[model samples]
Target: MSRKEKTWWWVAGIAILVYCLFPIAWIVSVSFKPPADLNSGGFLPDNATFDNYRTILTGNAKDLFRPALRNSFGICLIATAISCLLSMFAAYAIARLDFPGKKLILSTALVVAIFPVISIVTPLFNVWRQIGLYDTWLGLIIPYLSLTLPISIWTMSAFFREIPWEMEQAAQVDGATTWQAFRKVIVPLAAPGVFTTAIIAFFIAWNDFVYGISLTSTDAARPVPAALGLFSGASQFEDPTGAIAAAAVIVTIPVVVLVLLFQRRIVAGLTNGAVKG
Candidate 1:
């Protein structure tokens, strides 16, 4: 509130902004530089072009790995949709309704969330192979649901608890059923939380490499992260760094845009019920 404090705050804000943007600035800068200059010690590109993007995009079908991008997009989007929907209802019930052993169930979900994902990978891989789901998109998705589901439930439950029970009671008094109140009234007020949870779930699935790499074998089922590993370095396929940088840029752009667009909702989701209404 004082002049000195305000000046210090402004200086701190600029410092944080530069720190966060520095990596992005470097990535974009690298994306333009020639292959020869990729390792060169330079902050800015001396010879920049779109050739990296063009080369990767127009490369041969066998080596380009474009199909992996499609796979990642389709799988991540679908998994996020399902995970968000399931989390909303679970959160609603836990927040708004009383059930036998409700606290126990919530406790179990939290415990499961704390368990290391790597610990289950072996058994999961075995089960997937036994059930004939191994090396398939669905196989990867099933595990991904686990990754997104617990957090989604936790986040959504916190959000729903912020809404007063009186709102739902009022809706019921006006002839709305419980489901109707949830669908029409509660969901609308919780739209920001839902959007925020969906984005989180999407990114969880999108950025996943462990499951994608272990579960899927072929290009058709493998996601972009796995494909990136496969495409890098080749005696026959020289000049892969440029392609790698280009792919990194392409994969990163959408997430950055989405985060910026829905940042308001994300902040609301994180802070919605911090203070009692």
Candidate 2:
């Protein structure tokens, strides 16, 4: 490419980056803006303070951030853990073990993944309510399993396929049983892929807004996304734009931190699995 072309490419790339990041930057920036200048129609505020954050952190209100944060974290953590354990073993089985209907099983996984979970939310909600699981973390966790399991199976299956059979054969030669070989050999080898899938599952459960909003009304079970919607209620605060932005920033920090912490493993797992055999 010519110098002009290279310059244009760099400019285009920076513009795209800025466009993507601008909304996120604005959320964080407005979180620090004084309520007086909250929606002052400017990117930067005249006076900035941590009052919005303090309100979210220490303010005494029916729907506060701490409990919502705790609830979201707990639900996401439990859902991710359950999904990861089941997916890891399921992926191993699907990739390595021979079965009468392996192809049928994989095809079913694909079909289930393509279906939207929203369609069944009402029925699930009704069932949970009937069984007294509604508005509870267990209720949320059950639905989340359906959300993450298919993707985890597919992604982890790809990683498992990349493992050479010779590794398992060697373990078997050393008197390791089938389960032992998988536990000691295959699992450690697929650690990066396992972590990557867990992160994906956690984020999916965390960002789920539809189920969180529809299934729970009380603050005790509602997550940050659901609770954030309360700021714009017709009967509540006149204009809570700043408070909403502040809450958004607070909710986003945990996800950003998780991504940064596991970025290396995630990238490596994806690359290794995606590369041609």
Candidate 3:
């Protein structure tokens, strides 16, 4: 590339990075600021302190934040596990089997995935209440599956299609059952895809807010996103801005760590067979 082109690319890359990271940076900065410095109109806090973190960690908001954190972790993890398991099987069938309704199945998943969450929440809320699922962990997990499963199936199908068919055929010929070959051979080879799908599924369920808030009236099954919405200051007059920012930063930590740790697997899963070998 020409030096001018390289310079322009560098400029564009830096601009995009700054645009994306600026909000996170601002949140981190605000998290360290005390209540008094929240309105100081500065990018960096003049009196940086740990008070906001403490507030959410061990102070007045502990009861609200900690339980919600647990709920978010548990629900997302369970949802991701179920989504990955079910998607792996369904995707394998879609990719490998010459079954009827293959196109129809994929199309249905696509349609369901694109369906608006808001449009369904009202009837879902009534249904859950009637079925004794409202304000429960299962309630959130079920809707989360609706969000995570279709995408998981789509991504894993792409990965499965890329895997060499001969590998599974050889395994089956060597006296292994089809299910055994799939479980012992195909699944391990798709580890990167599985990890990628799990992270994506977890993120979808973790960041969910509408169902979290709409279905649950209390913290019993309320997730971090919903709990963060209900954060209150000492009194009605006080704003929970710093506490909210701190909680946001804390909630963001796991996502950042997951991306940093598995970024290579994620990239590989995404680009596994984009180009012909």
Top candidate by TM-score: 3
Better of 2 and 3 by lDDT: 3
Tell me the tens digit of each residue's lDDT in model 3 across 98-180: 98899999999999999999999999999999999999999999999999999999999999998899999999999999999
In model 3, which regions exceed 4 Å deviation? none
Sort order, lDDT high to low: 3, 2, 1
Model 2 CA deviation exceeding 4 Å by range: 61-63, 232-237
lDDT of 2 by residue, 103-197 (tens): 88778888887888789989988998899988899888988888888899998999999999999999999999998999999999999999899
Best by lDDT: 3
TM-score of predicted structure 3: 0.97
* Candidate 1 local distance difference test against the native: 0.85
Q: Give all candidate RMSDs, comma-separated.
A: 2.0, 2.0, 1.0
What's the TM-score of each model vs. the native?
Answer: 0.92, 0.93, 0.97
lDDT tens per residue, model 1, 39-111: 7989888898887777667754335468888899999998999999999999998998898988897888888
The weakest ten consecutive residues by lDDT in model 2 span: 231-240
